[model samples]
Structure formats: C-alpha cells, structure tokens
Target: MNTMTLWHITPAEFAVLAFAALLVGFSKTAVSGANTVSLAIFAAVLPARESTGVLLPILIVGDVLAVLTYRRHAHWPTLWRLFPAVGAGVVLGTVFLLWADDEIVRTSIGAILLLMAAVTVWRRRTAEKEEDPDEVTTRAGRAKARSYGVLGGFTTMVANAGGPVMSMYLLSAGFRKLGFLGTSAFFFLIVNVSKVPFSAGLGLIDGPSLLLDAALAVFVVPGALLGKWAVNRINQRLFEQLVIAATVVGGVQLLVR
Candidate 1:
C-alpha cells in the first residue's frame, strides 16, 4: 500500500467537502448520475489523488440509497449485456491512469462530452419516429450499445464522468422515466462496484479517504430528500434537459482546468 500524509483539512475545507458530498448524493439518486460534477469539485478543492480516494466511500453510500429506490425498475438485460464490454474498457482505463497526466485525462473527458452532446443533438434533429424493437435489435441498436458501453466504461473508470455518456445513450434509446432511472442505477451499481479494487490497487483508497468519507456521510441524507423532491416535481423533458446542461458545464470545466 502506498503511504500518504493526512493533510490537516481546515473546517472550511471540510465544509466544502461536505457540500460536494451532498451534491453527489443528490446527483446519484435524483439526477441520473451527474455526481461527476461533485467529483470534479472535490478534486478541484483537494489533491486529485486524494480526491478520488475520499469520494469513493461517499459515493457508495449514495449508491446504496439509489439502488434501494430504483431496484424494481432496472432493465437487467441491458445491464448484463453491457458488462463485458464495459469491463474491458475499465481495464484499459486503469492501465491508462497508471501513466497518464491530469491534463490528458481532462481533455479526453471534454472531447467525449462534446462528442456525446453532438450525437444527442444530431439525433434530436434527424431521428424519425422511434424504430420498432425488431428494427432496433437488428443492427443499429447493437452497434450503439457496444459503442456506448465502451465509452461509458472508459470515461467512468478514468474520471467518474460516464453519466453524460450513458445519459446520451439512454436518451437516444427512448426509455421512459422509470426505465431510464432503473437502467442507470443498475449500470452504475456494477460499474462503481467494479472500480473499488482498481482504485485500491491504484492507491486512491486509503485511511485519510475513509476519514473524509465518514465526515461527509451526514450530508447525504438531505441531498437524497432533495433529489426525491426534484424527481417528482420536475417534468421528464425538463429533467433531462437539466441533466444535459449540468453535464455540459461539468465537462467544460474539466477540460478547461
């Protein structure tokens, strides 16, 4: 295990950390995985290496709540189908992180977000009536699924920012509200769970991180409640739009910094 010094975080910094954790909890459960923004905020406010370590445990707590809330709605077939490809991408990402610089990672994430955003716009403009299941399953769906799976896995493993990638895919797939939440919840449960060992191996999980996590757990409750309210009050179209907007902003921030 790598030895790390525990920086003496001030009360103000601890408050910032708690606020970020709150956003993460809300994003995880209510906003369809925009917690990447919270991750970025945490990273910006702390050491990048330590940020990843500190945030993982907080995320797990949020994830448990999300799974509990959305378990019945998951599309297991989609989750299972994406796993092999996503796992491959995760392996590739972990290897890349072993040597890559922060700028490179940030730039890659920005490019991906732009690509996904462009695809989403193009589909919105040109897509005809939704293709029937038979049409979907034949050629286009499989190819799209494979592409999204690979992208999601790589982006998530590297930066915890796969929310936008998967959001675009799920949006284009034309899932209803419940299905979207369910699919996302299940997908991330697996992806995040898989990341634990790799994170540990990469020295992103350690004692100080656990201490930070413990401090932030208290904020998750209010975030979850707020998320519940947001999900119920926001119409589907607006909700999705907000998610896209948040993702775009977060992606741009990552790229710029």
Candidate 2:
C-alpha cells in the first residue's frame, strides 16, 4: 500500500490511470454520467477483471468527496427504494464474475455499457414528456426503480458502469441537477463500499490493486475541486449531452478494444 509495493504498471499506464481517477472525481461532482470515460480507461489500462477491482477504491474516494459536498440535497426515499433490488443485482453480478472467463467478462461488460449509453440518450430525449417526481412509492414507480436499480447494481459491480443508468433514471424522475448529484453520490459511496468484500472474495482485489488505488487516489482531490468550480458555469443540458456522448465513446472503445 506504499510506493515500494506499487508495481505492474508502466509510467504511461500510471499516467493514464491517474487521469482516469481525476475523471472519476470530476464525474462524481460535475457531470453525472461521464465516469464511463474513466471506466473505459481503467479497463484499457489494466486487466479487465483486475481493473474493476483497482478502480473501486478510487471510486469510493470520489464518492466520499461527492457526498461530503452534496449530502444535504440527497433524496433518501429513492435510495431506500432502490437498495433491495440493487443488493440482489450485486449478488447476481458476483455470481457471474466468479464463473466467467476474462473474454466473457469483457464482452458482456462492453455490450452492457453500450446498451446503457444508448438507453440514456433515448431517455434524455423523452424525459420532457415524463411525469414529474416519479417517486418510488407507487407500484408503477417502484417497478421502474427496481428495473433501474438492478441494472445499476449489476453494471456497477461488473464494470463500474452504473452512472449513466442512474442518471437516466433520475432525470426521468424529474430531479433537478443538485438533487440528482446528491442522490447519486450517496448511492455510489454506499454501494461501492459494499462491493469490497465481494470483490476480495472473488480474488479480484488484493495487494497489487490496493497499491495502485492508493497511488491514483491523490489525483481525485484536484479533479473534485475543479468539478465543484465548474459545475455552476456549465450549461446543465449541455453537460448532460456531453456526458452521454462520452459514455457512447467509452462504450465503443471498450467494445472494440
């Protein structure tokens, strides 16, 4: 977990991962769906399965920074409704991880990311016609939450690709920008922390990954600071479009990589 223990990466790969970590923090605070760029970069820089393990800790650091900054605006009811389905989905993802080969993992994850990115774009276009405040109390709303939550949990557990799924869900539910970020921050911090045990159990995380995570964690601070500064200046609609665009690009990279 120190400088001496860190190995298995070139200077270039380390630089790439560090920049990806910065994107993790920036995506957490400024753009809701842009973390797919970091996900694709991590998967590109490391072994596909190992990348998921390495990136989890760095994501938690970003999540922590996000929650600290936006805790007050979180909509807890939506979080509460999503937890059960998400937990089930996480367990399913763990099962898949334990049995799948590296190729299977890569192809499945790549496909899922691409599909989710497409879905996010479609939802953004249709969001204007959806009802306001699609809370999860009603049966229809609960079904919607369950669907998105399960997808979010599985994708997140498998490839750290849940941001766009949740972004689409929240946008469809009529949350303003701050509320969306706050809820997402809380959701990911708790969920990513919970995945640690499962990841270690699957042998996906270990000493090497931890050391790598430690080295990348430092870059998150500046990324977070810049995100906090930039969020207010960016056009919210434009930012969302950029995020979806980045998600699509990342998905394609993963697919073709």
Among these predicted structures, which one has the highest TM-score?
1
lDDT of 1: 0.78
Q: Write the per-residue lDDT of candidate 1 for residues 31-147, one digit (tens) a residue.
A: 864776787778787776557667777777777777888789887777776788888888888998899877788889878987897788678679886543233455667888888
lDDT of 2 at 240: 70
Query: Where's the lowest-lDDT run of ten residues in candidate 2?
Result: 1-10
Candidate 2: tens digits of C-alpha lDDT, residues 130-240: 546644568888898899899889888888877777877786677777888899999999999999999989777888778778889999989998888988888768767
C-alpha root-mean-square deviation, candidate 2: 2.5
| Residue-pair clashes per candidate | 0, 0
The lDDT per prediction is 0.78, 0.82
